[model samples]
Target: MVRDLTALTTDMSLQEAVRIFSMTRVTGLPVVNDKQQVIGFLSEADVIGAIMPRSRDMSGIFLSDFGEIARKMGQARELSVGDYMTERPVTVTEDINLSTVSETMLMERLKTLPVVRDEKLVGVINRTDVCSKLMEDREAI
Candidate 1:
């Protein structure tokens, strides 16, 4: 588990979130509430979808004109993370086994998962975490 995690608040502006993403090189971030409970998730794709034109399936077809896309991108600067975050995203408890986490990630197609304990965000698990754990186990074996 990665104890040093970056999280965002629902009221944070999309522009700020984008800056965080760029600085951290993270694809997604957990959105927490006042009590530090995970409430939603923000992804780079979500931000791009808000700015760029795309179908429901997220196919990158160039249907909109440059002016229209530019206008939407500009409008997106004022939007908050809550406006585009995935509410009630898949999460896991800190005590969950690695196998279970791997299975959940595989089944749900998640890249990252927020770790919670007693309904509060504690850490995060990502594909890198899974791989690192597996490598460690292999080394032990």
Candidate 2:
């Protein structure tokens, strides 16, 4: 698990979140409250989904032009992380076994998961971490 994990607050602007995502090179982040309790999860897909026009709402007009995409992004800048974050995101306990963590992530289709201890954020685990650990164990055998 990555102990030096970055987290997002619900009140943070989507633009700020995007900046953090770019700087940290992370595709997703756990959203926490003042108490550091994980409340939601945000991903690049979520951010893009928020800015893109839904098919039903598009009414046949394609947003293919760069100007149209830029306009949507500008509007998204006004939104907060809470507006698009996935509430009550699936999380794993700190003591969970690696196999269980892998299974959960696979079933949920998540690339990363927040690790909690007593319901408070502790760290994060991703698929890479799992693979690395497995490879290390194999080497040790």
Candidate 3:
């Protein structure tokens, strides 16, 4: 489990979110409320989907016109993180077993999950963390 986690609030601009994503080099962030409760989840793909024109693949350069791309990018700056966040995101509890968490993450195709305690944001867990734990267990055995 990663105790040192960075989170974004609803009111933050999409530009700020992008900056955080770049600096942290993470694909997503948990969106928290005033009380530090996880309210939503924001991923890089989500931001890209919001900023770019509709495409079957996010990285696909379907927009042949540069002006449309520029317009979309400018529009993204005006929007807030709340506009692109996925509300009521899937989450996991601190006490959940590693296998269960791994299974859930795989089934949902989630890269990261907010670790909650009493419905409050505490830490975060990702595939890397779970994989590390598995290795540790194997080595110990």
Candidate 4:
């Protein structure tokens, strides 16, 4: 139900993905193969995970480790998007209903879902794009 999905390859550097995200004004993109099949998803969170440092989640120390954890987060960035992205990601078909797509994304905690046809990546649908459409459904916010 969604189209015009931006995609990337897992072999690409994380920096490249971040550059794409910044340049495209999209928070995330789908990771596909040479055949253009959905392989994984590269998201802002994944990018953050790649750049963010790996540290002990001391979220319970000093009466809640939020500060300590944040301190560690400041020094992270030792991985790549290929290292962070889930190897096996969820996929969808172009004929899938809009409600189904939306539900799957929300329920699966997905940032983007590639639209495939006969196992070929055709386009992408993302929560941000979907939400943007739904926002117009509202009379007022």
Candidate 5:
């Protein structure tokens, strides 16, 4: 079972979440509640969308179009995770088989799924993790 994981709480701001994602270079995280119970999830894509630069209606081609996008990005505020996190994300137990994981991911197109035991968060399983496992298995062939 995979063990290395980066966890954060729901109360954490999107700004902080983005900071952690940048610092760790990860794409997703488990959102835990006040009791340290896993409650939701946050993705880098969502965070980026939250701070996405607005498109300007510069019908006439102007050299300053790029400048406007930059200005909009700069003016964007430090958003909050609670405003964007996906609540009650799909999860699985550690004892589940790889086939089940593959089925859920394929059906849901999920990037990652938290591993929970006894209603508590423990680790995570993601596409990257499965890819790593597949590579390792092939190497053993």
Candidate 6:
């Protein structure tokens, strides 16, 4: 797990979140409250989905011109992380076993999981972290 992790606040704007994502090169980040408690998660997918036009038909078809796309993106930029973040995100405790962590990631189809202690933000575990630890354990055996 990465002990040095970047966290977002609920009130942060989507534009700021995008900037953070670009700077950190992370696909997702955990959102925390003022008490540093994990509350939600924001991902690139969430941001993109927020700006994209939702399909109105059962066939899942939609059309938008560049102007419409730009307008939606402008609106998204004014929104806060809370508006699009996944609330009550799946998280792991520090004591969780590696297998359980891996299973959770797979089951949720998540690339990252925030590690919490006493409901507070602590660190994060990514797919690479799990795979590397597994490989090291195998080599040690």
TM per model? 0.89, 0.89, 0.90, 0.71, 0.75, 0.91
lDDT of 4 at 96: 81
Query: What TM-score, to 2 decimals, does candidate 3 have?
Result: 0.90
Tell me the deviation in Å of residue 87 in model 5: 0.7
Q: Put down candidate 2 lDDT per residue, 44-65, tens digits, no spaces.
A: 9999887766553445546575
TM-score rank order: 6, 3, 1, 2, 5, 4
Residues 1-141 of candidate 1: C-alpha lDDT, one tens digit per residue: 889558999889899999998998889999999999999999998898787765534554565556677887787768899999999999899889999999999998888999998878998899999999999999999
Clashing pairs in 1: none
| Candidates by lDDT, descending order | 6, 2, 3, 1, 5, 4
Q: State the weakest 10-residue window (summed lDDT) of model 1.
A: 55-64
What candidate 4 gets wrong by more than 4 Å, as runs, is 58-80, 132-141
Compare the candidates by TM-score and give the number of the best one: 6
Best by lDDT: 6
Residue 136, candidate 3: alpha-carbon lDDT: 96
lDDT of 4: 0.72
lDDT of 6 by residue, 2-118 (tens): 996589998898899999999998999999998899999999999988776665557553454456668878776688999999999999999999999999999999999999999
Error of 2 at 107 (Å): 1.1
Expressed as tens digits, the lDDT of each residue in 1-141 for candidate 5 is: 568557877667776787788897778898887665778889987776655544535565356665754654564344567778888889999998877887898898888899988768888898877778778878999
Q: Write the per-residue lDDT of candidate 4 for residues 90-129, one digit (tens) a residue.
A: 8887778767877998899887787888877788787877
Residue clash pairs of candidate 3: none
lDDT measured at residue 131 in model 4 versus the true structure, 0 to 100? 85
lDDT of 1: 0.88
> Mind giving the per-residue lDDT tens digits that candidate 3 earns over 1-141?
899559999999889999998999888999999889999999998998787666546566764755677887887778899989999999988889999998999899999999998778999998899999999999999
Q: What does candidate 1 score on TM?
A: 0.89
Error of 3 at 103 (Å): 0.7
Stretch of 10 with least lDDT, candidate 4: 71-80
Q: After superposition, how far is residue 4 of candidate 2 from its true place, in Å?
A: 2.1
In model 2, pairs of residues that clash are none
Residue 100, model 6: Cα distance from true site in angstroms:
0.3
